[model samples]
Target chain A: MRVGIVVFPGSNCDRDCARAVAEVSGRPAAWIWHKDRDLGGADLVIVPGGFSYGDYLRCGAIARFSPVMEEVVAFARRGGPVIGICNGFQILTEAGLLPGALMRNVGLKFICQDVHLSVGDTGSPLLGGYRPGQVVRMPVAHADGRFHADAETLSRIEGEGRVAFRYCDAEGRVGGPSNPNGSLAAIAGIVSPGGNVLGMMPHPERAAEAILGGTDGRALFVAALSRAA
Target chain B: MKARVYVTLRQGVLDPQGRAVLHALSSLGFDQVRDARIGKYVELEIADGPRDEAEKAVREMARRLLANPVIEDFRVEIPGEGEAR
Candidate 1:
């Protein structure tokens, strides 16, 4: 399966995403420039992490207006599989491909550390490999990783079981000091209502290899790539 | 026309930066300061146009780019236009 990784100006994780995809799927990921309007016939699209457009005017705010994002939005509308990691998650939220917004860390500081995420809904194709309540370790690096939604939206997301992951302890217990960013309800990731789009703050790609200290994130890539096969 | 936009977190949304400022003020012994909220102020220059039209356009700009409706509220003001909207 061909994977397309969007490259925005200042995007530092594009190559990391590519390497992870290549390692997991045995296919070299294509680079889709932000200025380009096509996905280059990719079966899956990834919006990788990084400081896009120097993170000006809010993270992912300007990147969502990129020419390529127009196509990404359309592709997602057609039920294409899309995974947005970190800044990519921010971009997806800004593009309205996903719900809610990511706000500043409650502590008002940039954080970079390993965080345990409890898998919530694995019904989504991208996360089907994970079992509900399973805890996976991944690195989260961002200042605006706090997930926030209006009460109504939060209830709807919960009611629909759209939550994909929540920050948790190694034992899978949720909340408290384990919630690094002070995200509402400890949300670490969420999937679109249709279950085709998955957006998460943790660097799954960064944790996909054993050499990187863990392979918990490989399941997501394997599941996503297997679907295309 | 010159337009100024104010973008702030929605009333219910938490503002960490604002809280930090509040804490800093308290640490500095500013006991009278009760609350602090941080927001962005953007200034724009628009082509001369009808007063109502300019206001409408600026409001649109605020909605589309200057602020995110999911977590922010924005106000537009044209100087000498009486009040902000």
Candidate 2:
């Protein structure tokens, strides 16, 4: 798969995300800058983590108007695969590709640590490697990872099986101990209505390699690649 | 002529920064705070011209750059004589 990572001015995780795709999927992804209006012929587009534009006017607010986003939106509308991780998740929500919004942590502090995530299902490619409610360890770091959606939208997402991952412990239970960011319904990630676009607060690219981190995040990219290919 | 824009998070969405401020106030021994929400507003002075043209440009500014309509909504108010604030 030809993967592409959008690079904003303050996107610190772009390289890591590219490396993750290259190592895990054996695909050398391209880096698309924020100013460019083209996507450079990528099958899967990834909006990587980190504070875009320093999270100045709300996370992803300024970056949404970036020139490349127009093409990204068009690509997504054409049923191409797209993933938004961490602040990328914030960007997806800001761009209206995903529902709900990320609020401040319940503890109101910047949380940067390894977190436990539970695969909710194998419906979407992002979690195709795991069974329902399977536990996986990955790192999460964000001050505004608390997901908030209206009652109607939240129910629609759950009822439609759009929730891809949930926060959980080793035993696969949802709560404060398992969910560090206090996301609504312990949601760690969600897919779009069409299931082609995904937005999550955790950093899957950070743990894609066992040498540098853990291999738990590796399967996610592989799954996307398999489907995209 | 001058134009002002107001931006705010939609209803039913949580405002973490506003909540933090309220928590800080409560911890400072001040209670009775019902709620708090944060928003941004900007005022811009521009050339005098057709009112319709000015409003259209300002609205484009809001949609294209000033606001993210998905999470937050924005409004433009070009103050005029005999106008309500």
TM per model?
0.97, 0.88
List residue ranges in candidate 2 displaced over 4 A: B27-29, B50-75, B81-85
Model 2: colliding residue pairs: none
Global lDDT of each candidate:
0.92, 0.85
Q: For each prediction, how big is the interface RMSD? A: 0.6, 2.7
lDDT of 2 by residue, A1-229 (tens): 6888999999989999989888877768899999988899888899999999999867888888798988988898898899999999998888888998887787779999888887765387666767777788889989988988878899999999898788888777777677887788999899998888999888888888887578888888888888877
lDDT string, candidate 1, A1-229, tens digits: 7899999999998998898989987879999999997899988999999999999999999999999999999999999999999999999999999999999999888999999999996489889889998999989999999999999999998989999999999999998999999999999999999999999999999999999888988998999888755
RMSD of 2: 2.7
Which numbered prediction scores highest in TM-score against the true structure? 1
Residue B19 CA error for candidate 1 (Å)? 0.9
List runs of model 1 lying over 4 Å from the truth: B81-85
Best prediction by DockQ: 1
Model 2 reaches what TM-score against the true structure? 0.88
Candidate 1 lDDT (Cα, 0 to 1):
0.92
